[model samples]
Target: MHKPNQTKQATARGRGAGYNPDIRFDRVSRASFDDGWDMVEDLPVLRTQVREESAKTIISTNRSPDLSFDQSINPYRGCEHGCIYCFARPSHAFLGLSPGLDFETQLTVKPNAAMLLEKALRNPRYTPKTIAIGTNTDPYQPIEKTREIMREILGVLSDFNHPLAIVTKGTLIGRDIDLLAPMAAKGLLRVGISVTTLDPEVSRKLEPRVPNPAARLRVIRALSDAGIPVRVMISPVIPALTDHEVEAIVAAAKDAGAVAASSILLRLPREVAPLFRDWLATHYPDRAARIMNRVRELHGGKDYDPTFGKRMTGQGVWAELQHQRFKQASARYGLDRRLPPLRTDLFAVPPQAGDQMALF
Candidate 1:
């Protein structure tokens, strides 16, 4: 890991904002200080490393009531889109890594994901259902351009005629228009594009390395123009910071041809809480305390509450006000009225060469 000097730390806003040592491993944490001296400084540049993971199974099943899908596939373990408030950051702790910088700089790629998915679909007991992608991390994150792992997974799904849903903040998904457009036509695919804020500066500091706000809107337009159903996700509606942009984001997505919309209140579960608080202090020091105070109110005077029902959208006045705003905006924009459901009937196991033909 590269260490930033005082000057670099002051100027480098997003790249190393939440860079912290692994608390689980380090007994003592060190901080750097600069003494006025004539010495050359080397600016720190974080490099990404991909460690291939050998996964036996690709499909992950969960019974969480708040979720829309029952199963999902994650092609990668860590995300390059360093969203400070991402709730998925804690997952990196299980791998003995820091949830701060390690969650963004160090990543694991499951190179055999496509093959494993094909094998899972071939199981006789496997049932057809909408398998979600990008639930844990964006499948189309920066490395996807070079790895092309996500593209291969989509190709496998297309071959097996598998129905799947995707939620991503990456613009790279636009590259797969040929695959997504056809699957959407067959009612096998639906996409949710997450737009945090329309403010370019806010997006840059909050979700470092993600596509710009304008670029994300362009993604919505492109996907929709290709005849793929697009849903705009205004997720993790940070109370005081970005809550005001609710209506504006909804209108923009609707104008771009997105048919539906959804949102989630900011969830600061575990390690993400401190990381997000640090981000608030760095970017918006003036309102950091007020923002966190409101967040606590939403989570019942705690940093977070994992209760499923109240998790996505919190409880009480603030939560209700946010929900009502979204409801009114969506209604005014004619979003989320009657979007088509992803079809599971189209799913079928690809026939092997030795497969016997059924007699009619």
Candidate 2:
């Protein structure tokens, strides 16, 4: 007989912030355990990952007002950092996988990513535009250390003088100091480090495998000191949870050398909603209801509203309050303004080998 869908309503957020992911379906229940998940994984277990490739050399562009860039590239899918509240978790649904463990354990690495990018860049119709990385999945996540896929992509971008932006939570980026520093000198790059909370307990439970808040601040300092523009992203300002640190986090990043700063409210999209709910019920049972209640209030009295204009910043009293706090604190720290724009004028496509027809 086929196994039943045994894990109904997985939770994604308790150990983290609002990005927690858990799987749930029909007629499934979890095993009753006396101790919590923290007790269950005392010893480190080797994580599993799946690698794959796509046929395309390049991905097309779509317009989104919230995001700055039109085109993007992801060398890997499914981050291994295992942050429970990762919004990218639901992307696993496309492959008929659960957003819980499947998202962290089953990953895809594209070995030919740099080759394909170079090919696309050399295309006649290709125009140099800022290609966003680390938008969907972190390029510098744990697996990067071994795979080095992101490093290869950066090499290609540097060769062609392409403008790029990265958002990350790992310290692995420090390894790319050589590439990023020169790009920064040319005003061709920017980096954003997401700092969710200052409290260690909160950081451990929420982001689990990612770097600590202090470590992330060091990233800001290191990147900024190297001349790269650093933005402190106080992301997903979790109400009744992480919202308290909005000002303090900003203050810390500014003092550390960050030249700019921004914040985004928590977003619970599709499979993410149920997973986050399950996490709340499992971990913070007492405040679960209140947290969801506040999320709805910020999201216009609903779990989530997909309205394009309202998605990034949400709405209502709580959202407005979070925005106000960020605005005031950022202004005070001289981080209210946007960083200088990157230069795309340096981009150039080199000729392929034996294209003697051009010389003739």
TM-score of each: 0.92, 0.87
lDDT of candidate model 2 versus the reference: 0.79
Q: Score candidate 1 by lDDT.
A: 0.86
Which regions in candidate 2 have their CA more than 4 angstroms from the true location? Answer: 1-46, 351-360
Kindly list the per-residue Cα lDDT of model 1 for residues 1-360, writing each as its tens digit: 233212244334456345654555556554556566879777666677789999999999989999988999999998989888888888887887777788887899999999998888888998988889999999999999999999999999998788889999999999999999999889899999999999998888889899998999999999999999988999979988899999999999998889999989999988788778777877899999999999999989988999989888888898999999999999999895867677778787777789899889
Q: Provide the lDDT at 243 for model 2.
A: 90
lDDT per residue for candidate 2 within 304-325, as digits (tens), equals: 8878889879888778878898
For each of the candidates, give the backbone clash count.
0, 17
User: Lowest-lDDT window of 10 residues in candidate 1?
Assistant: 1-10
CA RMSD per model (angstroms) = 3.0, 4.9
Best by lDDT: 1
Clashing pairs in 1: none
lDDT of each: 0.86, 0.79
Off-target runs (Cα >4 Å) in candidate 1 are: 1-16, 21-43, 353-360
